[model samples]
Target chain A: EAGVAQSPRYKIIEKRQSVAFWCNPISGHATLYWYQQILGQGPKLLIQFQNNGVVDDSQLPKDRFSAERLKGVDSTLKIQPAKLEDSAVYLCASSLASSGRGLMSEQFFGPGTRLTVL
Target chain B: AQSVTQPDIHITVSEGASLELRCNYSYGATPYLFWYVQSPGQGLQLLLKYFSGDTLVQGIKGFEAEFKRSQSSFNLRKPSVHWSDAAEYFCAISSASKIIFGSGTRLSIRP
Candidate 1:
């Protein structure tokens, strides 16, 4: 089966410019997530979507970052007026729906988009 | 708040040597634990997971992790190191419909 797919494996933008990243999750997957991974650090959760509806986005910086999954299949994350601190890899992941036992399924990740803000 | 901690930032061992990476978590209840490996320019891949049942979970690529409740730790181990095993390893905990990841451990194998 095909895994999660992302676009523009690498990106470069100037500070204060806007950037966007795209993600297409695995087929039939019901949950999608966006994460930001700074150098030498683990990926941090930016937002989570369950079938086009947001499940969690508490950690997201609303002032500069936003994400949406319109059809519950693909997602997009945007950052406006980006800062140097925003330079990091943006990762997308997807997982199957929760089971009757309420167990979280394994997450499949994409190659990620490395955004370099100069 | 729930969190995962990887105490080691980087570790190096000779090829064919044993390897271990430490992980600790903070949560109120039992959590689902996982170990993922990320190679350079690649996405994270699940190595193993522990939800219930056996505390010692075996994963792909000959990786294994032991979940210790008393210590609140889930440590990954490999019997022998391989050059291909060089990668960033992350420990994660899932609970209350949320998942948290550790800072990650970088593994390097010496020839």
Candidate 2:
């Protein structure tokens, strides 16, 4: 089976510039997520989507970051007026939707897009 | 607010030695725990997860994690360490349809 796919494994942009990262989840997976991993830190959940609807995005910085999933398959995360602090790896993961009783399927991750804001 | 913690920032172990990484979580109910490994410039990989049933769950790559509800901890253990095991390990918990990760523990193998 193919794994989650992401584009531009690496990216570089100047501060205040806009950048976008894309993700294509595993086929048939119903849940998708976007995370940000800073150097020497664990990946932080940025947003989560169950199908075409958002499940949670409370941690996301609404002023600068936005994300969307279309057709419940592909997702895009965008950051505008990027700052140096935004330099980090953006990871995408997907899993089968909740089976019931609050059980979650294992999540498969992509190689991730490393965004370097200079 | 649910959270996961890896008390150790980094650990070094000789090749062929036993290895253990610590993880602790804070949640109200029976927590869903997971351990993931991330190599340099790579995304996270699931090592193992604990939801219910057996307290000790074995995972791929000869890794295992034991969930101790009383202590609120899910620690990863490997009987023998390999050079290839060097990487960042994260412990996570799923709550309210979201997963939260710890800061991560970096493992270095000594030849």
Candidate lDDT (C-alpha), each: 0.92, 0.92
Q: Write the residue-wise lDDT of candidate 1 on A14-110 in tens digits.
A: 9999999999999999999899999999998899898999988999999999999998899999999899999999999999974432236888999
Note each model's CA RMSD in angstroms: 1.4, 1.4
**Pairs in clash, predicted candidate 2:** none
Off by over 4 Å in 2: A99-103
Which window of ten consecutive residues has the lowest lDDT sum in model 2 chain A?
A: A97-106
In the range B28-65, model 2's lDDT, one tens digit per residue, is 99898999999987888999888899999999999999
lDDT for model 2 = 0.92
lDDT of 1 at A37: 98
**Deviation of model 1 at A25, angstroms:** 0.5
- DockQ (0 to 1) for model 1: 0.61
What tens digits encode model 2's per-residue C-alpha lDDT throughout A6-90? 9989999999999999999999999898999998888888998889998878889999999999789999999998999999999
Which digits, one per residue and each the tens of the lDDT, describe model 1 over residues B12-70?
99999999999999988888999999999999999999989989999999999999999
